[model samples]
Target: MKLSFLVLAGAQLGGVLGLWPQPRSLQTGSSVLKLAPTFDIHVNVAHAPSDLEDAVSRTKGFLRNDKLGRLIVGRGASDSAAIQHARSLNTLQLSLVHGSVVKSITDEARLPLGTRSEEYTLYVPADGSSATITANSTLGLLRGLTTFEQLWYEYGGQVYTVEAPISITDSPAYPYRGLMLDTSRNFFPVSDIKRTLDAMSWVKMSEFHWHVTDSQSFPLRGARP
Candidate 1:
């Protein structure tokens, strides 16, 4: 019997090393990425769904906001600046496209037949010429965008992402990524419910089991035919 621990000399652990529910694979190369202030999102599909468009817009809004406290994955960037002097680097933009990924996560990617998978692959070049997030469905694109934002942090009044030339391929380990709320027992306000759903979507939760009815109370209206 034997055990071995391979240590990453250049890489650190925790927020300093990765994201929450870290990707199944995250390989980092040398260099740093100074995220563009106008870091925009573009969809490559022929006709992006309205919901997908809306998600991309929202992702664009939050990705460049220095005020967003969610980019705490790798906290202190003071000493990690790749380029000390503000030199002209390529302005990187996020591009999302439709694609399938069945490697390693074949079961999760294909199970529950006809399900819209939330599997995605994100690649950011060390040169910073561009970045891309590819997924099999819109759900996957959303997750990719969330991971993109988490890669950035504010340091010395500049937004940057360490560990450049990054490649991440991830999918849910379990098929049921879900959340539930018993509105029949304790109804959350419509606005509050919406906010909760939005947060869940950001975290890439695929299902929301809303308990709208129970033996004690029936609170939801039926859908119109």
Candidate 2:
């Protein structure tokens, strides 16, 4: 027998500010930012910047609209490492030249978040020349990227546009934000679980509680057994 269940999640973006769970702080600007059919992404690499590189790569992969253009990655300033190792670091900078197809993104510092740190600050300059997303850890970067992606809307059913010129600084109010899923009672397939995870990521959810064993059945197989 095949059983299907629907899960409903709600998110809200209000006038340059997101209403879903609400960020710590948000400021809206006057101008609207838009992306061209194609654009360039430049990643500044200095030392072993694997984490930042991976962040950019994953972000690019998420945005598979084909509207993205050339990807240029190079070595940044020598002091880049020093900046990344700072303690009180929580800032991101994003710059986009209006009428230009080039966008520059930089993370200020990658501070260590003990256990859970969803804290991030995003800035979209009113001048429209740039924007930034700052966070303490790579996890914060992931959250910021998810929020940034939500800013873009599809046009004519093909193109993606970001109505920007806004600033947002967000951090989770609660450290433990997650959802619980019961597989024993209903037996959800792997694909279904993945789909749920995708949705959770979009909303900056950090946990997935799987209740696999119950009175109904123990579908989970043990590798040792």
RMSD of 2: 14.8
Q: In candidate 2, what are the lDDT values of residues 1-225, reduced to their tens digit?
A: 122222222222335332356677766644434443343345322232465566566665555463432122422133234323322211234322223222112232222223455567776553335457656555565677777655543333222323346677888876667899988888687999999987776687666788888876989778995
- On TM-score, the candidate that comes out on top is 1
lDDT of 1 by residue, 27-64 (tens): 87646667665555666765556766776677656655
Q: How many residue pairs clash in each candidate?
A: 1, 14
Give candidate 1's total backbone clashes: 1
The residue-level lDDT of candidate 2 at 45 comes to 23
Q: Which residue runs does candidate 2 get wrong by more than 4 Å?
A: 1-14, 17-19, 41-55, 61-114, 157-163
Q: TM-scores for all candidates?
A: 0.72, 0.63
Which runs in model 1 stand beyond 4 Å of their true positions?
1-18, 66-114, 220-225
- Residue pairs in clash, model 1: 15-73
lDDT of each: 0.65, 0.52
